[model samples]
Target: MSDASFLSFLDDPGFLAAFVEVSRPRAHGAGLDPYDYDRVTAPLASAHDWPAACAAAGQRYAEAAGRAAAEGRGVTAGEAYRTAARWYHVAGWLPHPDREAAARTAADADEAMRRALAHLDPAAERVEGDGFAGWLRRPSGGPAASRPVVLVVPGMDSGKEEFHTVVEALLARGSAVLAIDGPGQGVLTAGSAPEPDYHRVVGRAIDALADRDGLDPDRIAVVGLSLGGYYAATAAAHEPRVRAAALVSGPYRLAWDELPPFVRATLVQRCGGSEAARAFAARLDMTALVPALTVPVLVVEGGEDVIPGVTNATPLAAEAPAAELLLVPHGNHLLGTALPDWLPTAADWLTGHLTAQR
Candidate 1:
């Protein structure tokens, strides 16, 4: 047998290259400062070392958060816990060979986020369902009984814990935010397969949040990034309860055969096999599906976010009759490089639509 045949996919040159390259922008976009990303990853030389290296950093911050909390330094504790959570969250992305251990690591990330929110926003609530989990929070000092709601959905290989900035942005604009991780995402990945009919997952989220006090059920909006963007668009088209949406770096279509091996492998891991991954990939295309969406939509595209085998959101924006497009030339897939230009604008767009006197 060839030595190559026995090697873990983590060691494959292409997998290593793509994981390392993609990790930075995704980390930064998710809340890690770029400088911290460099420093944390500098000593790492291989994908196999990635989880341990990141977890070590996460442990350090987690300890710091603990100490800060014990000292009654609430702000410091909050910041430390958030940083710790981000590290652990980053650590959980790889589809490791030790599936049980990988799942434990995911749980650690999930727990850290809960602690972070306890310190950061005491009002934050954890919401869960059959195939999803989320942190639901309202605007600071929001008015009683009808604050517009926004569902902040994360992408494939992303979780509810990562989009802190997006959640905060939406909260700042008077929207109650639910940052969610659905099937094949966040902590749920260990148990659930990816659902290409993501609208169902979202429908369940809406049902969970529907009767909550101080959140307007009829005024719900969605802001999703990457694969989550596709999910949000899917829900907007089919779930009539979704009043508005913002898509960030979502694919307009996906061709299974053309996808990068890392992406395909991730899907394979989540979808159960190569054939299932192929089937799910085919379901991701929105070339014809998005045109029927009637709610106000904002599609945010990173001009530089060219991924193999994926069609970007530009065409979705152009085709959806109610869509408005925001293109950022220097942004990476998640706009980690150009946040200021797109984040607020999109948040404003969503809140405006949700709060409009409709």
Candidate 2:
């Protein structure tokens, strides 16, 4: 609960791994299960092998995704979906350029999406925005052009690919979707952008979505995974155009004071050692900055979360003028796979707000 306790937890490598394992069910349920779950479970697990496993998983996922796209399944095919999930898992476990490698895996995912779209009606387009950018996926069937729109944001370590399942699910529900690589995420991190000032980066994403063709604009909803939740909440508050918002396995308060030690250690490890990790940590002040959002908001939390405790969601719900909280009993930090059950709830809530625009 306190900052010290959180930091202490982050310092222990064993504890971090254990917490991750415990969080697996949630991630698995959410469709983001990593490939190393079984391999990493061996006693005395070798950290060195983690990268190799991640790379292999990424390659496999790329191939599978391509196959799925060719089959008109949009990354939902058993092989492609599993591969994408493995990429998320592997990326989390892999090292530096490995993170970059994970992004590359995401690029393959983009290709898969493109391939799938090609099979559809080809309403997709590569759009350029102010601070951020992405490809917009619109429905292809007919001119029944009144579909709801969703703006999907990736997590801290995730890229646009991670939301492949989410996009498919929303699209199936007759909604147009836009998935983007926000700052410090995907292409932005690989490119010149630094860790973005949340407001500026997400505001630009909203700006981009609002201007797209055939989009209801008024029926736009925002969904953020992991750290994207913070950005989504902030954007929903400041940008009135976002009718509703959902925080998927994301925390409410920034927890500048209380990040679990395992998380800190993981960051340190991700940055390639302890010193760099500390330096990176110093740059972040996790305190929740958004006061109160008027938009209809859905806050999803993991019951056994190690990174951001379940308690974090409480304050966020309190901060939102109209908010609903869904606690996944066995969930972790990843909520994408849990879409089957959660998406409907999300769609229902969003429909109430977005459809009322008439």
Query: Highest TM-score, which number?
Result: 1
lDDT of 2 by residue, 49-89 (tens): 44455456556665766677677785355455445444544
Error of 1 at 46 (Å): 1.4
lDDT of 2: 0.59
lDDT of 1 at 149: 85
User: Best by lDDT, which number?
Assistant: 1
Model 1 / residue 49 / CA error / Å: 0.8
Error of 2 at 253 (Å): 2.4
Least accurate stretch of 10 residues (summed lDDT) in model 1?
1-10
- In order, what lDDT does every prediction score? 0.83, 0.59
Q: Which stretches of candidate 1 lie over 4 Å from their true place?
A: 1-9, 12-18
Candidate 1's error at 260, in angstroms?
1.1
- Can you give the TM-score per candidate against the true fold? 0.94, 0.74
